[model samples]
Target chain A: MNLTAEEKGILQGAQGKGMQLALSTLVRYGEAFAADRMVEIHSAHLAGSFGAFIYRTYYDAIRLMVKEGLKVKVPATLNPRPLEKIKFLDRIMISQQGFLEASLAKLGVTPNYSCVCYDRENIPPQGAMLAWAESSAVQFANSVLGARTNRNSVTIDLCSAVTGKTPRFGYLLDQNRRGQVLVKVKAKKIDFPALGFLLGKKVVNRVPVLEHLECTRDDLKNMGAAMAASGAVALFHIEGVTPEAPTMKDIFDREPDEIITITEEELASLRSFEKSKPEMVVFGCPHLTMSEVKTLGEFYRGKQVKLPTYFCMIPRVRQELGGTDLLRDLEAAGVRVTAQCPLAAWTIRALGRKTILTNSGKLYYYLHKSEYGATEDCLKFSGVSS
Target chain B: MKELQGRGIISGQATGKALVTSQPLNLTSGLSKPWNLFNRLAAVYYDRHHELYKKDLYNRVLVFPQTIGSTFTGMVILETIRRGRAPLAMVVQQADTLLTSGLILAEVWLHKKVPLIEVPDPQLFNLIKTNDLVEVNGDTGAIRIIG
Candidate 1:
């Protein structure tokens, strides 16, 4: 791959050893993808802060870089960390969280611990290039917002954060962004998350254009997250819905590479389990938006939760909803508002196992096998007898 | 011995018994249950294939279609390698940037090399079988099937 004189200088340690290492790693990574050159990235959202405790090597690497006086050159934000004041955390987990927070501070990353950083912290313009790592966030940026980003890995995202550039290949380029599959949605009552799960399974690694589906931005967000979870799809265009494709013709070139039709039965079949008694109910997998939080608050206000219900949100969103009656109502209903990812938090081993009921297709897909029992949709557990 | 050509994502060499899967592997969740908690010994495969559910991935050549699910694939691969429970090498039908990034970080941080090569040919999957002694040269993108 061709590099600019400045890139060459950085590789040669003209900038610093930390930069040389970072550039070298990125150059190797780019070569693996056959990227011709580097593209300047508008922003970066890293995935390192959350799970750094499980993998000490990641924490050590960041600490070393910080000790070398290296900091991110571009605007960057971190994924969610464990809630600092949570009572359930053990001593070891607490220390690990503190260690990660300090390391991130040294690296100059904004403490905006959100998987949905695109929602508020860094909303890139349509077609703007980015280096974001979280799968759901990557899907949201690419499919819903029309910004361009690959499903970048965690370490590679950090490299891009330091350099403000990423390999100019894959989803970053225009030719690779066209829809290859046509998915006709025949389901009248569109379960956005289930549709996304089914669509992802149908079109693995190929971009799909949805037909006859009208969806809101929040619906698209849930759909994109499920799709990315169930399949390797980084981007999808909804006909006349998403920003990129205003019409069917706008998404496909001459003809769609393939076509698949999804029926109501097919979407229904995507649900993993029918009914089960739930020990816990989880709401947010990609972190809840402000609207979602409000809606949940209203729904569960007077009703008492039969089980331990956890509503996960980013710190920013939680802060925005602070001092409102909605927050008070949620707290009164025995709902614990958290800033940490439930998926990552469960890795603590000490958290133990419980039958979890979640509305998130992404969460259900990942945890169904491991947990005692994971059922789709919290409504299934809502009216169940305790 | 039959040689198959592929694109090398991570450069290295290894010879090991092969573990082939027809389905895509979700490196994050498929490897084990949540209760395992990064313990390679207790790690159990949670895919549809029940035969390989409890099989060990350590020092074996893992051949699969592609990686599915989670951007945390890189981190999972890194942790598996860190625990010395990773496959000796990997051969995929297509290049996966998420998986490759983990191998790259493992190479850099752990000073360990696990060759990863992608064979785009559909027939290659049919040609290789389980427990075949395969020699992988990631630098040259060659897989020698030694029977």
Candidate 2:
């Protein structure tokens, strides 16, 4: 791997112990991927908000960096914290949260503790090189915003942030961003997240270009999350919708290597919550934005839910929706809104044997007891009516 | 003794019973929840969607096509290796970034090196069995399927 003089200096312990270790970590990681040179990134989003208690080595490494007064060289945002404001949260994980939070704070990371970092904090322009983590965010940044990054692991994200550069390889190259598969959506009622789920299962690890589809920005977010969860899909295209693929020729140089058609039946076949009523409903796997919160809040306006329901939103959403009638309605309907990652918060152990009904295919795919439910179905099951 | 050559992603050696599967493992969803603290399920493969559900991943030569799911998978693998609950070493058909990230981090940051071999051949499944004792040498890129 070719390193700049300054990068070489850091590896030779010119920057200090923290940087030396961080750079060495990147160098090894980069060499594995056969990256020729390191590319400076505009920003980074980390997948390191939780897992400190069990990830002792990870936290210990962070503590060392924090002690060294090391700060992220680039603008960095964080993933969700553990679900602290809930009943089923594991107490042990909660107790360990403060240390990680403090460590992240000292690292000079932006306090945007959510997965959808592109929506607000650290939004990258078209073709911006990034070292972001969190699969959903990476997908959105690459496909939706036309930013470039691979599905970087947590440590890689951190090391890149510390050095402000990621090894140039994978999605960083223009040729790699081309769509490998053609996915045509033939579903009558499009469940964007479900379609994403199916797309992931079918085209695992390949970039898929959707031919016939129109979806909102929010739909893509939820769908992208599920795709990353069920499969390792980092970037996907909507042909006419996504930033890069304004036309089919832009993303596809030849006839797609393969083509798959998705129907509503295929999506419905993925739903397992039809028979048994769910005990709880979870709304966010890649936490909801303020706009999504306001939109979903309309369903609970003057009604109560039969089952426990939670809207796992970003902290910024709650802050923006503060003192509003939407928040009041959601609260009155007994909707527990928390700024935590549902994937980290509601584990299979947390909801052992109990069924979870969710609008997020990402959550449904991850949680063993969770089942997929459409927006209306989730509302109907929760005893909410228009 | 049947031996095979592959590429090494991490440098270490470990021998253990093989937990062989053709399916790509989602290490994130596979080992849900946190570590040994609340994670009594310690390194057990609990992804209900997977064929290896309820199988313990601890101290085994985990063989799979690759890994899928959340990027948080890196932390889970690192945590497991830290807690001594990770597979003895990973022998995979394809070594993607997520799998390498964990073991590499464990190696570079924590001084804990777990052997990771990328066979890149689909034929790897034909040679190894579920309970067969296998030795993997990451430094030499050597794999021994021993009975």
| Candidate that would win on DockQ | 2
> Which residue runs of candidate 2 sit more than 4 Å off their true CA positions?
A86-90, A348-354, B1-3, B14-16, B33-41
Specify the highest-TM-score model's number: 2
Candidate 1: residue B147 lDDT (0-100): 76
Model 1, span B1-147: residue lDDT tens: 888989888889999999998777887777745444536423356655444676777788999888878887887788778877789999999877798888888887778788999998787668899999999999999999997
Candidate 1 lDDT tens digits, A281-301? 877887888888876677777
Q: What DockQ was computed for model 2?
A: 0.70
Clashing pairs in 2: none
Report, for every candidate in turn, its global Cα lDDT versus the true structure. 0.79, 0.84
lDDT of 1: 0.79
Cα lDDT for residue A171, model 2? 93
User: Model 2 over residues A1-386: C-alpha lDDT tens digits?
Assistant: 98889999999999898889888888888888888999889999998887534567777778888998899989999998776663434654555677778888999999888998877887999999999899999989988899999888987788888889888889999988998999877777788889888888888898999984778899999899889888899999987899888889989989999999888799888777877768888887788988888888898988998889989998888888898889889999999889978777766146354688998988888776678888887888788863
Tens-digit per-residue lDDT, B9-97, candidate 2? 89888888999999889987767644434664388887665789889888888998899988878877887887777888989887888
List the pairs of residues colliding in candidate 1: none
In model 1 chain A, which range of ten residues has the least summed lDDT?
A: A368-377
